[model samples]
Target: MHLRRERSRKLIETFKASLTSFACEACGVDMEAIYGPLGAGYIEAHHRIPVAQLEPGQTTRLADLAAVCANCHRILHRNGLMSVEDLAAHLRARRGWPLAAEPRPEDWQGPDKG
Candidate 1:
């Protein structure tokens, strides 16, 4: 079935709004964290089930999508059929570390000075 552009766009907006921070769901890489102000609010929505594999008349659910950074998105496309959990595990293994600790208030270097 052909997915409507408007529907896809709406899904992406909804997903972004639902997230606390616009970070890659898989590896937790925030665009703003890496690129500073330039990367604010940047993320790509990935269909959990590849659109190409959807059967005719099938419905798309919000749960069927995830917000990913460009790097993760590209890896997903290149590797094909890999789940978000798979990529997260690969990243953790590649880095030889578990998820990093959350930034402390004193450790923050953003422009907000109060």
Candidate 2:
């Protein structure tokens, strides 16, 4: 169990380090752009595949994560783990913006499917 925890921690660290910018993927809110130095690297990491949904022995990859702001993160969970793309579309629809092309179902599946 310790090894599992260590691996999870390292994976999350690597995922965060891989981010070039801390912009919310769903809302496009760049923390640094809004709060300047204070928010330079302040975006939250959200699991595209909720951690609880992972089957035993399933592994997560960087692509399974999404960079999001506090508001969008909360909203995502509040709406029952809605996909990042779905939330973005919902927001765009509310603003009457043209919806982005839908992703294929396969696009939603993360790697390491068992």
Candidate 3:
């Protein structure tokens, strides 16, 4: 029974992970472009909020994640990142995509901070 429950938990996580890894939640770009960027794009899956910050017993939604290139993921999460929504919104606007109809919040200072 204990092992069964553990398997269930892992399966759930795997399903959620799969849902987010196929696309770049940040730019809506396909994972291929977000990852290796060429012959074989190899994107990585990122949890929007760090697992350490999650409330006890809480599981993050797959939509709250992103599939990004290794470098971008490192830049976005070198320290601790809250979420990439703001940066995503900015990129959206720059790309001329239909941006959020509401205002966007400021992104927290991340690894680039000195």
Candidate 4:
């Protein structure tokens, strides 16, 4: 499995700006963009299913990834672990932000999904 963790540049910036401008889905508090070890205001866009776990020839889609914060990301991948969706739902429920309903799951263009 490739361990290289790379992020889409434009997507990273957009996510940071979105998080900053938007309130936290879990706390309703404004959150600032957190940088990865690389120093960019981004964590990592994670797929609920790892690429290594997918069928051959499968590639990641833009909508397939979630812009999770560091703690959520850690909880996701820790212990060989849980699905990103589970973490997302936990975060959503924790903050009581709209993550499902009203906005279609596929139509989620950002935090409005709550």
The numbered model that scores best in TM-score is 1
Q: What TM value does model 2 have? A: 0.76
Q: Model 1, range 65-96, lDDT digits (tens) per residue?
A: 88888888889878966888888788767764
For 45-89, candidate 4 gives per-residue lDDT tens digits of 556567667676665555656655555567667847676656557
Question: Which pairs clash inside model 1?
Answer: none
Q: lDDT value for candidate 4?
A: 0.48
lDDT score, residue 35, model 1? 71
Whole-model lDDT for model 1 versus the true structure?
Answer: 0.74
The window of 10 residues in a row where model 3 has the poorest summed lDDT is 100-109
lDDT of 2 at 91: 71
TM-score of candidate 1 versus the correct structure, residues matched by position: 0.78
TM-score of each: 0.78, 0.76, 0.48, 0.47
Which segments of model 4 are wrong by more than 4 Å?
1-41, 91-114
Better of 3 and 4 by TM-score: 3
Error of 2 at 41 (Å): 1.1
Clashes of 2: 0
lDDT of 3 by residue, 1-114 (tens): 476457545744665457624444555454343234462434566776665667767766656556654555675776456356765676677756554322122232234443
Off by over 4 Å in 1: 1-3, 100-114
Error of 2 at 35 (Å): 0.9
lDDT for each candidate structure: 0.74, 0.75, 0.54, 0.48
Q: lDDT winner among the candidates?
A: 2
